[model samples]
Target chain A: MPNAQRKTSKYVDGRWSIVSSQRPKAIRALLGVLFLALSWVGAQSPAEITKQVQANLEKSPWEATVSGKAQLPDGSSQDVEFRLQVLPGKEQVARVEFKKPGSLEGNFVVISEKEVWNYLFLTNQLIIQPRAKANVQGLGVNLTSLGDFDQLNEQVSLKLLGEERTAEGAAWKLSGTPKDKTQGYSSMEILVLKADPRPLALTLKDAGGKTVADLAFKGFKRVNLTAKQLKKYPADAEVVRK
Target chain B: MMPNVVHGVPNAKRKAQDAKRRTVWVVRPASYAVRQTLNAPSLGARGEAAGGEGWGGVFHHGPRATGHRPRAFCFWLPAIGHRLSAIGDFRGGIFALVVAVVAHVLATSQAQSLTVGLFAAPGYISPTLEGSLELGGFSLSARLKRDSLGLGVEDDLEFGPAGRFVFGARGDLGFGLQPLAWGAEAYLRGSVAQFGLDARLGYASAPRAALWAGERNFSGFAGNFNASYRLDPANTLRASLAYAGDVPGAIFQGSTLGLEGSWALREGGATYLAGLGFRVGAYALLGWRGELGEEGTLLDATLRLGWVNRLELGLFQEELRLRLMTTFPLGGVPFEAAASLEAESLRGDVAYDNANGRWTVWLRYTFTFD
Candidate 1:
């Protein structure tokens, strides 16, 4: 899954204003030149940054744990936690195992290129459906997009809002506007770590500006994941295909 | 249904009664069972295959004779059960409470997942007290059952050379968790891409015939070679061929060649599960399970036309069986129920007796929390 640590809800726009009664023209001129040169070399377009992030993510199979509050389809918020594993290839496969929301604990979902497998722990039943027919949006948000940057880009148009420093490193803040009017979320903001070139957090908001999902990623690392491993389920689990 | 969280004010008095209050609400997992003999008279002398097994190390799917309960954490139930049994008096149901509390504490400390459930079944012949704790891939489930506290932890862990894919227990003697039936099983099943393979072996040594395995359990030595291929995203076809012996093969319901296929159909924005399968063994059997979806999957029903073993009659009896399973909420608690009715009316004997018609019903409440 995308690297994330949901930013705290508290936002304080505390800026220090510096005023100088005496101005040195030459020093100011030098600083302005230095600033422009830095911008020229350091600034990157949103597409370039997003594509680079996707490249870093698709380079290998990785696993991540995501946890936060997510808006339910009914507009209520609930604590949700899950582990996501993405096996990148010509055909990407993603596996999700829910860990929180006690009701959904032990349930798992596997998304292949063509199908989505929802395995219910209580019934030991695997419900399969064509990818197009299945609703992967979880908790009123596109959670799987957190694992696929390309899919995220396809769903929205991204623009680099700014950059900030965090404990992990400098991070680029990207604002996204849903391309599809009826998308679950009207807008979203993502924090992508510059050094690692992967998402660190994502916050989604509906058309009404209500927080839809605030997810954070942690414990992300590449592993030797195999197709057989990703496809494994209880052998006797009743199989149902749709 | 909504979960009823204990929202009462926290204090010494309330805290002291919290465990007791939960004891009244916690429930055992829902267990579904189907029993009764099959008389496949059409096939030669097939009575030996009947599961009314007597105890001579005859392997029975009987849960009451189980020494362990098969679960996702089948690997740990036995050891943990023994530890819990050795802890103190199970008759009081205090150990179950202790296990749940300890498990919950451990999970919270480690940031892991733990599910704790406990229930009492006084309607049974035995005053039964049961509890289970699940932590990640490891679990521990125990039941203080029977008049003499004959607790049998029955479950089998199936492991293939590659990995363990399935593990389960049968509710033969009813809720399958029996006291010290001393049965053991091991097997393996897994899939590689679209091709799936499964093989299993087991042994039953219930203390006595009626209590556990049969005297000459024909279900013993049950083995089968099964492979399933996914036709597409919406369909899967499994081909199973079983031999005369094997404890619990995937196709081990005594079928020689079993061809089964399952399909998931999308209709009116709802999913429906349909399966078609038939088994040709010493006696032929055809069966399939379907989901009755109305405003959701309201019920699961299975229909089977086949032959069953009549151990006493030494013949195969033609039989038709219909089983219905459903889950519903009662007072905010979810309860699972299953009923199977098999009639030999096709043989001109609709008599509901030991020889002709047989039926089994199972009901259990599932109140679980993490």
Candidate 2:
């Protein structure tokens, strides 16, 4: 009877060990399939990524505070603080405060989805200009006050030039050209985060193959903004409606 | 009684002839009376200063015995009247003809005229057309334009699409002072976007001569001093320095320097133009926000072929353009309509706003008046 009990226990222990050995191999196979699927999804064109980003940006209204230093063309540097409020299915509004080191100091411009208002802080007056004609002169980039993604595609051709890891370690890389020959931009590169496919950086170059502007976004916080916060532009700030 | 006197005069004449074989004759008072009654209007003495001899001395006196000479009094009156009337009529007719010819010549030389128009592209592309009429050293011009674009936004946002259509009128008064050409223009522009007041001063030193200085709202304080020598009537080689900059509140302020040359083949109608340009300095100073710099180098080449009737075909890079244009009699109004198809290959890295590699169709139109 003692020998029979010992044989039964040994048989059970061997069976459990065999099942454990086979399970690990099955799990490895499943993991391999999942990785291949993820890579295939990452290889989509920029148009595909644009569609996805547009859909996601439209899904919710978010607020973000952005702070950065820009290198100006004159070899000078300036610190910029930007406050942005985006409303889903509506226009995005932003207030930018600019501060330079010396004699160059003023509260100048306000941009909404439809218009751009220039404030002369000294005289406390605002100059409203059409969003279409407003000259925001850093890099000849004319942001359409009411442009859609499809219209943007018309202005600049979007192509998925393949994925690349940017110097700043972005999630995805997208490259494109200005389909409109007259659009001053020579080409565009967008660095998007892989986790949410959000654009983290954008660079604009002129027709002469020189970098005109480079923008990077840091500390992005996705928050549901209130309607009141979205309307933060000053009432006296001259509104320029398209 | 007169006959008796004349008989006495004959007896005296016979005695005088007998006494004067040496040719001496005497006439009495009765003979004088008879001469006076028969003499008609006297013919003025011929060669009076030296009236020494009569014609050949054939008779040595007037006709002696002729019947009364018949005179046609009515014929004289009518012939004189007819000649005088004809002379008067011809004088009046010639004056009227001269006046009519002068009026016709003046009317034919006095007509001169111009027209302009503008159109828009599908995207934020705008082009302009202008026409001018030159008359008596002055040119009046009309300009039309369509501009579509987004307004003001910072580096991070997507610009919305907006557009404006503009129509303007300008008058240029030019003076051709030999080695120097000078002109000034005053313009008023009205548009759906903004109202503008424009004034310009221009000086050009001949067509091939290098220096030009002009100011326009769009081009800013622009000066182009290019030294060009004509290789032939159809080709030119040029080296130039050009500068243009805008003030703080103006539209475009970038400055650039360029080197360019043009060649014409098969006459001036077909041309090949090539240019290389580099941006030189700060484009603008936007207050304390930042300074915009004009940075880059551009290389461009274009070939244009024109037909006899002012039809042009242009091949530029990957673009093909066909245009039809003509000038009419009234003020040299030229109407040009063009269509183009462009396919371009792009490779480079651009600071990104919101564009990926893509393809699109572009259409543009413009008009010029002169």
Q: List, residue by residue over B183-235, the lDDT tens digit for candidate 1.
A: 33333444422344444444443211112211222233444444544443333
Per-residue C-alpha lDDT of model 2 across residues B126-205, encoded as one tens digit per residue: 12222233234332232222211101111111121111111222222111112222222221111110111111122222
Residue A232 Cα positional deviation in candidate 1, in Å, after optimal superposition: 1.6
Q: By summed lDDT, which 10 consecutive residues of candidate 2 chain A come out lowest?
A: A233-242
Q: What is the C-alpha lDDT of each candidate?
A: 0.42, 0.31
TM-score of chain A of each: 0.81, 0.65
What is candidate 1's local distance difference test score? 0.42
> CAPRI band of model 1?
incorrect
iRMS values for every prediction: 16.3, 40.6
Poorest 10 consecutive residues by lDDT, candidate 1 chain B: B39-48
lDDT tens readout by residue for model 1, A125-217? 465656775665676554445576777777888877777787788788888888988778898998888888988888889888989989887
